[model samples]
Target: MDNEGRESGHLMLITPERVFYAGLLGRPHQRCSGAFHVYVAIKGGLRLAAEGAVEGYSELAVVPPNLRHTIASDYRSVICVLIEPETVCVGALDLLAKRLAGAERQFFVGRIHAACEQLQHEPRDGDIFSSAFDIMCFGDALPRRILDARVVKAIAQIGRFSGDPVTAASCAAEAGLSSSRFLHLFKQETGISFRSFRAWKRARHLLHFANQDLNLAHLAQHIGYPDSTHFSHSIRRFYGLKPRAIFSGSRDLAIYRSGRAAAGDSAWTQEAG
Candidate 1:
């Protein structure tokens, strides 16, 4: 919310026939669980932001994680094409950055648009990700990015006990691996540490309690924060603003939202058009 006008729980849907997209790279109230590759093409746009706005939002850029996050859509033109969360691993993303090197605005779109179109036409059932992977295997064609079978088995063990007090040691044990090995596999597949990733996943559950009507302290406790101060600090340190800043008065943000709503699919600008 520092300026790109996005907040937690803002989703860009990607259906079988469509790639649901959001121009605003909503900063979060908490850390992010995972990272994925995105092939962006912009006619003219704002710099991506982690906090505070960026100037003269640019044409096209590839975003990598562990950097300050910023996504701004300028009044002139904005276009972004995003890959879904589970598609490609962080290593795959890093590999793409090393191999591709062109600054021209339009160079990226044709490649990505063609990939998306290829996925859109594939058969609709049972493991569409695999079909899509085969269609868009422009990178190293690694299975690590496709979420290993063992990793898939571990996902539920980590996710199921959310309401209970949990620690990485316990989570790692549940996955039947030594703590160090568990962490290495998790980071390789997900692009984040096990601790931060769990917290990132936890924030989604915390969202329901974040409504304006709720007391901030109460909301913090409800989301597993035993101390309200700790929660507030975490919110600020991670997303660059306290929780209260979101939904506070910001006319430009409001205008941006309304226009996004009205445009619907048309909200996807030329680069992604």
Candidate 2:
């Protein structure tokens, strides 16, 4: 590890379609996330087991979206990359994963490790975006998936989480389509059901507050969960860690939100308390 990385401790760079995290691995439990996940070991190697896949240990690993998986490393800290499924072509990501498994595996591992070090020393107020994330790790941006105009508008609405709840019916109304049609089109466009997309978005928003000192109930309300019970259950289901565990592990981490953060909020960045 570089001196900057060691000094910085833990860092999370979050954007609407990409996240680069260098932090605690936490307990290796089954986590089904909504992104194309890539794990790069810092020192030794990572052991990963995904649904319908053989268990393996390597310095690099990739898991597709919505797959239940667990990963562990010899060390407590590791680098993780998350590429949101809706933003890019899944086939492209799959191909990229395969290429990484080939000769390029060591190349990307070196790139990511170097990027982690560079990011740690970057200006706190610097703006980061998904394109930048790709360039940082892969030398170029990945191909983007274009959606229908109406579907794009609906996605924008869902991405912008507010106190008001987001629903397929409401989104359908806004898109001038029947609920059934809207749902069908959404699945066609994103390769994911509307319910699952919205749920994952809500759960993903938790990363924004991972380092905050706040009440879980209030946080749940802020995230638009019906109640703390539902919030806890949903968080555990998606992340394989309790909400408290996430926050606790991130106590000393720095969270940098890009100009277009996952929540579709205005750009800003903050250090963890």
Candidate 3:
């Protein structure tokens, strides 16, 4: 596991609403992520900075949802955990962030590194869940969010078929609201606009093919992008690296996608509050 330059050191476990990555840290470019992101150093400390925010080296750092930031580690590999804002309560997420970057920092850093070593040897397709992942890292499952039913239905449609294009207007009709109204309710319920929510979903879909050998243009088209230009720009904007760089860095990455697939309408609607 100490062999940072080796391909075997890269691993990523991706679920429907969460991700855990112990892999390469590409150039430190500004990234505006849509999820609550936490970074932990494997060996040396990391430098984390955002415009108008504190900037320095730390063993662990937290970046809140939708914040533009840059993170770099002295070592080649780092551990990153991403929690989609829609899946957890605001208070719970904030507490998780604080604990990870606070007094419990060393404990989590050790647990995460140990977990990475164990996971690397497990079957790549084994079932993995956000709850299980949380327990492993934080010793408990984080609280879930209760969103409105109409918003839940919209989320289900957009996430059900990841590569398919879903329009706000279509979702609005299905939710029994006008486009304007649906847009308003979506932002109110999720704290994110409908367009941005969909865009983030599409960009996130790229993870499924991150370790594969595929054409960028075809992959872009496959994921509902209009063209390669738009695809590249979106990926860069969200991830801070170009598509080619991501694919290249992940060529040897062990990507685990098994777990809860997109929530079915029936499954999601039950949680509507």
Candidate 4:
């Protein structure tokens, strides 16, 4: 979902994890600007359309910014929390976020979602925010013991490289599987395809740099975008706002409910890159 048409809300989580309820529906109008990060859980089933192809995400889909997407499901879904990029250190949490993204579409096997709900119901923002800040400031990068080493290996390969050579066929070859087999099992274990995962990773990479002192074109290359226009198109899908606005801490559009920022009206996003 793009953030453009949706309202952006803030929450402070104090635990190691938290969960919140979320719903997705179809509307007559196109939507822009969604979560900087997105995890989809559908009841009964999940359907998504990207580019021109439509598919099902049985467990959940880890989606980034705009790629022209939507969902259709009868089951109830609880969208998990997105750790404020500005408030915490990313290290292992990035790994954790990726790991959860791969969970079963039911995706109901972790403290992550539970923690998200806790944060949502918690009364005070101070305690939760402070606790989460500590974890972000000190947590280690994702450990190998959490999931199948093969999965980690696959993610590492993609995260470290890009371009046409970095296709699904290549990644499957590295894992000693055919492309078809790779997509099937990969989704079974990770809940998303290699392609969508890579796109999500790329979008996150760009967001980390959106606040930097780099031009759009150079920043595009940094995140593996072939050109600035394409880069703009990607972020705009999810945020529905240009890079310039996010970089400037565009408060005119800052998502505060009723002119209130529980965190003291402060919207400074720290350098996560």
Report lDDT per candidate: 0.44, 0.84, 0.82, 0.44
lDDT tens per residue, model 1, 117-230 = 443343223323432342353422433334554454455455443476666676567667788987787777665676776564444343333323567676777667668777
What are the models' TM-scores?
0.52, 0.91, 0.91, 0.43
Model 4: per-residue lDDT, tens digit, 1-273?
124313432232222122232432322122332233344442354555444555655445544333455554555333433432222232444544466555432333334444444433433333333344323322322221133444556665665545553567877787787899877765555545667666656664454343245677776786687788877777665544556655554221112111121233122322211
How big is the positional error of residue 270 in model 1, measured in Å on the Cα after superposition?
Answer: 40
**Worst window of 10 by summed lDDT in candidate 4:** 252-261
Q: In model 1, which residue pairs have backbone atoms overlapping below 3 Å?
A: 13-20, 45-57, 45-58, 46-57, 47-57, 48-70, 49-69, 49-70, 49-71, 50-69
Q: What is the per-residue lDDT of model 3 for residues 102-210, given as tens digits with 9 covering 90 to 100?
A: 8888888888777777777663456666667777767788877767888878887887655457899998898788899989989987889999998998898898889
How many residue pairs clash (N, CA or C atoms closer than 3 angstroms) in each of the candidate models, in the order given?
Answer: 10, 0, 0, 27
Model 2 spans > 4 angstroms off: 1-8, 261-273
| Higher-ranked by lDDT: 2 or 3 | 2
In model 3, state the lDDT of residue 22.
85
The CA lDDT at 171 in model 1 is 58
lDDT of 4 at 74: 52
Q: Give the best candidate by TM-score.
A: 2
